[model samples]
Target: MSPSTLQAPEIAMRPALRFITCGSVDDGKSTLIGRLLYERQLILDDQLSALERDSRRHGTAGEGVDFSLLLDGLEAEREQGITIDVAYRYFATARRSFIVADTPGHEQYTRNMVTGASNADLAVLLVDARKGLLDQTRRHAIIAAMLGIRHMVLAVNKIDLVDFDRAVFERIVAAFNDFAATLGFRTITAIPLSARFGDNVAERSQRTPWYAGPPLIDLLEQIDVEDDRSGKPFRMPVQWVNRPDASFRGFCGTIVSGAVKAGDEIVVLPSGRVTTVKEVLAPGADGKAETGDSVTLTLTEETDVARGDMLAAPRARPQVADQFAAHIVWMSPEALLPGRSYLMKVNHNSVLATVTDLKHRVDIQTLARLAAKTLSLNEVGVCNLSVARPIAVDAYADNRDTGGFVLIDRYSNETVAAGMIDFALRRATNIHRHAYTVNKAFRTALMHHKPAVLWFTGLPGSGKSTIANLVESGLHARGAHTMLLDGDNVRHGLNNDLGFTEADRVENIRRVAEVAKLMTEAGLIVLCSFISPFAAERRLAREMVQTGEFIEIFVDTPLEMCIVRDPKGLYRRALAGEIANFTGIGQPYERPEVPELHLLTPDRDPAQLAQDVIDELIRMKIL
Candidate 1:
């Protein structure tokens, strides 16, 4: 068969491939992409002339045009000769079409690479033949695997510099294969090439005749790029409520996965409202809708459906929950504040959300899970998130659209993190709040006094527990039901598993505040004494209780005084470097700025402070 006739069969059988190129800096990624475009005749004559002019002025190719200039369009990139952002390019050959993303190779810009690779079908990892696989190469490969790129092409670039030795190519391939096995990649292809000289990219290289493999272009053209969602259950997130007229209503969005047709049984998630598909309207299409189609769907019966609501097949409905365990990539310059509220955008839905716990941060080099309190820029961590309301979501491995989300700063509107849901916490769906007939109101009426929680916070050795004990004693003497929760005593039983790290401290305060809330709801006065160094965690505790029922009491004792009065010898241990993460020493204490009551403990006796608290409670009508 003639070459043209042979190419016709391959052209009719292949689909467009979307892939990304990434590795360490100066690995010839830009040059490889530019060479592919040039070979395909995608550049215009005017563009070629400008490229030649630019090459003459500032070129690294000596006498030839510097192909790297074609993709590095940013001023900073040109000046520094490094990629800083993801650059997307489109081109086609006689056999196949391609969409390629040129991603950054620097460690600080790893987040940009993640953004580009999120939608790619494959990855082309470039490696310097002289340096083999560097740390950045391993990082990119791991990230690509995490983003679900199963197909990889390890292009051993700059082969010309290494004299195109077949043994050198084999050694690099062996090492990469050993490491790639641990990543669970389905397919890995290694090729010997020189992107600068255009060898083994579009054409076979004569220098590496000892190595036998197809060129890079042939491998991309013949690879299967079919997705597995074609036969899965249908899912669509409502993007907008289409109300063209008083009589017409529809839900408009793109079908992210699976297939749907008219008369299919569907349910609106989190609401659990059942409905049938009345009509499926696609742009100039028949009566069916499939994945990637943007259409308007009308239900058989009128139901209250709005933006962020998910429509899914009733038999394969998604999990509805307000809490989830997720993997997050921190993108903002500011570190992730554990208890601070941020706006979470999942598909078309937005909700107020908080990172409730930081499970662990992944070490990109060693792939180890390290305990962490906060995630910094370009860091990856596992965390638990709590949303204001329940949302219909799937595990990210099952469906990317419904399981991926971004956290935006509420004040600045800047995107702070990118997250992928692993799964909903079991308690979120398994446990339900059961209401009892005898409630807080009946308990308060029986006690003949309003229930209240007095939270005492200060530095260590600040006389908080001493004052709290005396106040509880006074309340008991007056025939009032009361309980006192001292930090040390509770830590010995309830929070025995917790430590002194910031993350553990947050959990400790959270558990204690919850117990106190329950006690107050039982119609008893509750006193909580703890250092509670972080203001954010303290605020979270206050939010768990009823408005006006939580009263903050600040024990204003100077740090120097607490150190001098070191009752537990904790300060001495901290000063001697025998203890770590001690509040007032290694960690910081965020003092309450506007407590309901402030007591100066410098010259006051414990009984006097206790009497003052009782008098204040009486004035507030709590007695």
Candidate 2:
């Protein structure tokens, strides 16, 4: 063969490495990524020219092109000279491809950083050579480890500014190693580089003669990115059920772990139904279905299959339970309220769930477990979660796809927290609902009236208790069986341990709601009077009873008017800072958008308001 026509030996391409850049703000993360892209010839000529021009106009670097400008695409980010969101960039070398995520470093934007690290296989943590390690460095390390990133590279950037001192670099490495030892990373490679000058990033630098290691790009190109899932037991969460016609019925989803072939015996989870795989139709594949393959599966016999169900190897099925222990990272500005119902979405399955207990909050700085009743924004905690129905799940260490979940606020539809399953609680599987012969209908018929809950909600001094007492008196005189659950009275007994914090308030309402529900089952009209400030908790209470069995009575007294009345001198104490987290003072009271009865307390007498509630109940035929 002619020399020009000679074919070179084929070299196996390396698997793409997914990594993220993180650390304290202005630690040269963006510049490092920009320099790496430039050295790899990823930036086009016109882009380079624009970058140079912009660098001269608004860059921090005096003469050189501001490489950070390439990645900080947001105008706000450019103006503030900080990364505000996760910026993903793609590039390639001759040996391998790479997906790099540049994450924010500010504590306020920790949620954004989590988004970047969720899918990464490795992390490149940048540190200013002058500022060895900051609090943000520890936080980023903790988050990266929580997300299951096992490998890390501590890039001490701006070494040139530190005069390439070997001692300085050694101190940084030692400090980081001391901290990282607790994080459980398998490998931590520390390298000194000046990203501004492109030194030791893509090529070796003579200035760092004392340090001998491969360049950053070289290390990334050679590191193994392969994670073998073929040896694991088969697991595929059904994302969609495809039934186009009578002849075709298939379960479709991407296999998350292991492999499956035709005639393999599989078990559907949470159902325990066993069947043989009739055929595996993996589109664009030769045959069979492997991990990461999106395929349609056919069963040998007709079975009850549905979306959100799991298909797994019969011998290694996941745990099916209604409750589990999990590690959660609360991401919402509103603190996490225990006992409040939220929408928990895991894979394709979404369930009504409640954070049953706040075990403890993790201190990112010291990794200490501190007792906490609530979790604020960016706080990590261990908690118990109870779902409305049992779900098939694996520990996060075993399967990220089936064990990770997000809690969404049902009313706002906002993601408030992310959680990883640890294990199913033993009690969750042991407990079963006991069926009784005498039910709500039977009790209600005997009482000659429908069982119902009249929920009174408003500000603390909005006459909720006054109106509720009057209504209860009227019901008792009319021979209607009734029970009253005033918030303060219940607090002195059932919820005395609870406080006024949002979390405690939620638990308090939950207890009262359960009590009211039980009372209603005995055919008594249960009356609840409390400043149930949050609408979500009120909605939860309403859902416990049957339709029209729960009535929301809003005592719409203005805050100024409540403060003027100060029924129990609470507003005075709250205003004087004697009490913290008091409703309508330190804490917020969410006004009911729509209530069954909205009584403007200041405009009417207590008797009139109570009569309105009784009249409404009579009109609804609940009396």
Candidate 3:
């Protein structure tokens, strides 16, 4: 059934509590959740019989049924006896319904933990009673807090291993409280329990006579973490344009905050087009929709609204800008470097974005801000970002649905980082583009030729620069205004600050692309001779210019031949470990999947190869 058609009255009166269990490896997070299900009699008779058989083969509990088997359903997870992904289960009691996420504890799966915690209202952090506290325990707590989970429950599992010592439990609680003082959690409840033995899980156990607090399940049933999104300003991210036929048009999405009804004034964000709702189509008889309701609404006037556009109350609008600052959790094994382009996905909108600067990295150990140039895997940092176009957003503290985003690697399509928006940069609002009468067309007319960039790429000693020099000479002799940007020559001036690292190479290509773009505006035939290895950056360069204005010419030369020719001795140095991250030697070179021109230089002369590039440009009508 559609969510809009569901019985909303029951959900509104008593919503299910969403929570996650996270901690270091072997802290019994999955076992804790499984025990809750078992003790509450939520497991079926057949599943219990299967569990008993599987426990004998894969269970770590030795003689008894491994409760963790209930959640660790993956074959790989069962074989490895570890949680590698988030596992979710649903259960209910007379007091409440609950959805619990069992998140992995390994450092490599931190991204999985972040995904599970993103929508959770509370985090049930389990810790081994004998171990006290560990790095990953602290890391998970910090990430949960950053993702806007305001309530925390410290589940000190395996109290039976330590003979249910009250002092050990109190010491762990005190240490966590000290670190959590600045995390902004509204409540912190610590409980001692043995998930394997069912002590203090569903019901209070007499094992710890000194303990007076309620059991873990009772505390979860009574804790209140609702934020009352229905009482806030109306906001809905348009997920689709519902149009069955030409006779009707409607915007469809679930309301994330506040309420909307017929005749209510709404604004489409980023475009700021104002319109009134003509009709609301929902399950409710009143024709009104509030938070968590998926409905369709027709506008009174036709506005330029599309998917990714937000419908919001006119009086309380979200910030719209191309630049912002955010806290990021770097998830990829490849480090995040400033100035490299990435794809940012916020809501349904995807835009090209770059981390302009790494403001600082947060030390999980000390919570100190340390200066950093890059963020390694699992590192948390604050960064300033710039996007290709403006997007609507809200501060994460105000609205998570509109404020959270993920950065994706353009080539791999892997999610590299998760971010929480803080605010738009002041400079983004101040900077403005000035209009001019003399533009690219006027300059093209004055120069008497069309502008284009011939990007020559290949191995270092691939004769790219030698042929580019010849091409520029021919164009200049023909009175076609031209410029040559050799890779080595550029590093002496425009890219002097850059090194040979992968990150530096990405930034190097980015600056050269921008310069080439400006030179194209002046109606000059720009020749860029660089061994741009990564295909993503080369693609970025092509996209920066107008269609048909960028031509990629691949200089095909064998690696053995280049090593033998070694004009600059770069290959020898790279092979001897004198240089690092050198393309074709220390690092990988992603060959162009397709190119406009391919020149075989082993048998052909430099003059003939340069002629090939010129002929291709002529065929493109640039000559």
lDDT of 1: 0.89
| Model 2 lDDT, full chain set | 0.91
Question: Per model, how many backbone clashes are there?
Answer: 0, 0, 0
> For model 1, which pairs clash?
none
Q: Write the per-residue lDDT of candidate 1 for residues 412-471, one digit (tens) a residue.
A: 798888888999987766678889899999999988778999999999999999999999
Candidate 2: tens digits of C-alpha lDDT, residues 375-493? 99989999999998889999987887788899999989999998899999988455677887998789888888888999999988889999999999999998899999999899899
Ranking by lDDT: 3, 2, 1
Instruction: Compute the lDDT of residue 31 as modeled in candidate 2.
Output: 94
Model 3: how far is 105 from its true place, Å? 1.1
Off by over 4 Å in 3: 1-14
Query: Runs in model 1 with CA error above 4 Å?
Result: 1-14, 44-66, 73-76, 243-246, 285-287, 321-345, 350-390, 406-419, 422-430, 461-480, 552-576, 591-623
C-alpha RMSD by candidate, in order: 4.4, 2.1, 3.6
- Give every collision pair in model 3: none
- Candidate 3, 226: how far from true, in Å? 1.0
Residue 96: error of model 2 in Å?
0.7
Q: Which tens-of-lDDT digit does each residue in 572-591 have in candidate 3?
A: 99999998888888988888
